[model samples]
Target chain A: MSQVIVVTSGKGGVGKTTTTANLGVGLSKLGKKVVLIDTDIGLRNLDVVLGLENRIVYDLVDVVTGVCTPKQAAIKDKRFDGLFLIPAAQTKDKDSVTIEQMQDLCEKLKEDYDFIIIDCPAGIEQGFKNAIAGADKALIVTTPEVSAVRDADRIIGLLEANEIEEHYLIINRIRPDMVRRGDMMNVDDIIDILNIDLIGIVPDDQDIIISTNKGEPAVVNPKSLAGQGYRNITERLNGNNVPLMDLEGNTFLGKLKKLFTKKQ
Target chain B: MLDLSRIFGRKNNSKDAAKDRLKLVLVHDRANVSPEFLQKIKDEIMQVLAKYMDVSDGGLDINLTTATGEDGKSRVPAITANIPIKSIKQK
Candidate 1:
């Protein structure tokens, strides 16, 4: 059965959707049959992020409401063969689909896909509840800001209360320069606060904005630092001990030295 | 002569500033007690303590401290109240 994972954040606009889209593509690139589901409902944007908006005909609501089959709702990405998207309905509210319905849908999807990625909406409301209902694991995305970390902490508390302890942290939009300058929270600061397994750390990159606008995930662009970070996360997900990409130029020389030592 | 201006110079320490802001907000959030509410509580607690013994009226310290778990699973934030007794000096 496919591992159902929910990408969520308690606060809004912390790159949950972006991370979901890119990670879906990243995992698929690793030859894993991946399905990305948008559980946002009414305010769907994961389709736009994945550039599958124009292809979405029958949405998640359609599949849950029995108006359409799950196969009909699933939109295959042309760029990646094994990747698919189940977009959210733009008209229906989050209350239209219950948690049980979401669980049922995910259970059915698991038969075919290797990974089922749910793009959760902001806040701990019905949408959030529905997204995580069938999730075997969860990735909490948050920025380094105090407000974001505080909300993430609250979300972690809620997840633990719900007995969903298989969750990890992905610190997005990290500015290493600011961290070095003592202007922003570093990885250690975030790890100290959240106290979760660090799955990924994506640096703040203009390439993310550019690729997002162009309907391409940054992970596809090998030169992009954020892309490299997402790729490293994919490797980690596959049980590889891939060292994190050094965006701050801190580990470049060390890595080169290590390569020379291996050659020797 | 001491350089008093140097001693009292403006320091734009953003890290310290951010830490102060976060500490204040976290104390309020973890306790679910606003600064105004805390002021009231502080007064009431001081009054209640004063009934039993003499407390240093305005010198009491009430703050929150956070500690990490051994396995780093979660943070443990606790509220601490320190009230010093005003000793009556022998005349």
Candidate 2:
């Protein structure tokens, strides 16, 4: 059975969709059959992020409502053969789908795929609850800003209250330069505040915006730092002890020394 | 006596300001008591205390401190109340 992972943030615009898209591609590149599902419903954007918008003939609502089969709604990615996307219904509201419906859909998908990643909507509302209902684990995405960190804390509290185990944190849009200058919160600072297991740290790269605009996730681009970070996260998910990426140049030498010492 | 110069330093002053803000907010959030509501509660608590002891007005301090559990997963916020006995003496 596939492990269903929900990528969510209580606040919007914290790179939840981007993280979902890239992680989907990253896992697929690792030879895992991955399916990315957008559960935002009315305000769907995962289709656009995955560059599968034009091909979304049927949506998650269609499959859940019995209007169409799951096979019909699942859009296979052209860039990666094993990766698939189940786009959210742009016309229907989140009320159209129930939590049980989502759980059933995911259970069915789990039979065929190795990883089922759900891109959840912002806020702790019905949409958020529905997205997480079927998830085996959760990834709380947050930026380094104070508000984002606070929101992530609240989301963690909610998850714990719901008795959901196996939730981790992904600090996205980290500006290493700002962190070095004490202008932005670092990984340690965020982890201290949220108090969750760190799964990944993606740097703030301009290439992300460009790639996102082009309907391609930054993870596929080898030269993008963000892409490398996502790939490292993917390896870590597969139980590989991949060393965290050095964002600031100051840590490069230390990391190199550690690598050499490990070899010895 | 505390070192006046070091106590008044910019870094120390800024740190104090941040700590005060965080403490106030946390106390309010954990107690579900707003500033106005806290003032009222303080007044009522003082009135109740005054029945047995003479208490000074606006002399009570309350703060929220975190208590960590053995499992590291359980963290509870507890209210720490400080009421000076000297202040409670009859004036």
Candidate 3:
């Protein structure tokens, strides 16, 4: 069955595009046909993140307006087969694409692809509404901060009000050292506040910035801690019982435990 | 040797403070009530009550509170107004 999932965070700069791009690549790495739609419209960047910025012959607005087909607008990724991206229109504003048009596009995409991931724009505005229009589930990405958590709470209320039942949380940029020092909100604190099921927890790693800058999905980068988190999320999405990655950096005790276990 | 700051410091850390503030603010935000709105309601309520009784303005405490319902699971928003009445006006 095809699934349309909207990745959104009410606050900007909380890694919605990063999560969407990585998940798209991650899902396709599992051999699932996935198409990622950038619904940010004027503030489009998913194409850039995927390193396919130069190959945009058609965009989401073109597909919605019947200027081009969704298939024609979808850019196949060279790094992975079955992974495609529908770039948002840079010239047009968010108001150009209505919620119904987005829903229709998602409905059409659902027929061919195994997964249709919508990268929602930040804020509870028209763009956000359009992104979640046809999504069966939602993945809210947030950082471990009070402001981000608060915005995520508001978004959760909005999502519930919209009757989107299947939604999960993705806590991004978790700093274990800061969390251990009681200087940041831990995963448990966020879960207690948001009261939602956590799908993934991406650790704050420098590798993420490098990968994003290179326009490569971090999930494909084997050495990335955030990439491993995304892989676990993809597994969970596919109904596999994958364990969450420990954001805690390896302590002496943890290292000793691993060493003893490996010896056995 | 142990890190002294890790052991003795961080009693009133900013992280806990931030979490507390967010918890309080989100209660009002989720209930769709702002601080100004609550203050307005309190002022209007005090004004209405003062007309009927000798209500003191100093000891009045009107705020939005959260309490669990009969299910005892969900935290529900409740308004608690504590107005001090000096005497009842006889008309």
DockQ of each: 0.18, 0.14, 0.33
Residue-level lDDT of model 2, residues B20-86, one tens digit each, is 4443444345445566865676677767787767655556785556667579865566656677654
Report fnat for all candidates as fractions from 0 to 1. 0.17, 0.00, 0.43
Candidate 2: give the clashing pairs.
none
Q: What is the interface RMSD, in angstroms, for predicted model 2?
A: 10.2
- How many clashes show up per model? 0, 0, 0
Candidate 1 chain A lDDT trough over 10 residues, lowest sum: A255-264
Off by over 4 Å in 1: A250-264, B1-13, B19-24, B27-44, B54-61, B67-75, B82-91
User: Which residue runs does candidate 3 get wrong by more than 4 Å?
Assistant: A253-264, B1-10, B35-37, B51-53, B68-73, B85-91
Chain A vs. true chain A, TM-score per model, equals 0.94, 0.94, 0.95
Candidate 3 or 1, higher TM-score: 3
Enumerate residue pairs that collide in model 1.
none
lDDT tens digits by residue: candidate 1, A63-109: 99999999888999999989999999999888999999999999999
* lDDT winner between candidates 1 and 2: 1
Model 3 gets an lDDT of 0.89
Instruction: Give the TM-score comparing model 1 with the true structure, all chains together.
Output: 0.84
Clashing pairs in model 3, backbone N/Cα/C closer than 3 A: none
Best-to-worst TM-score order: 3, 1, 2
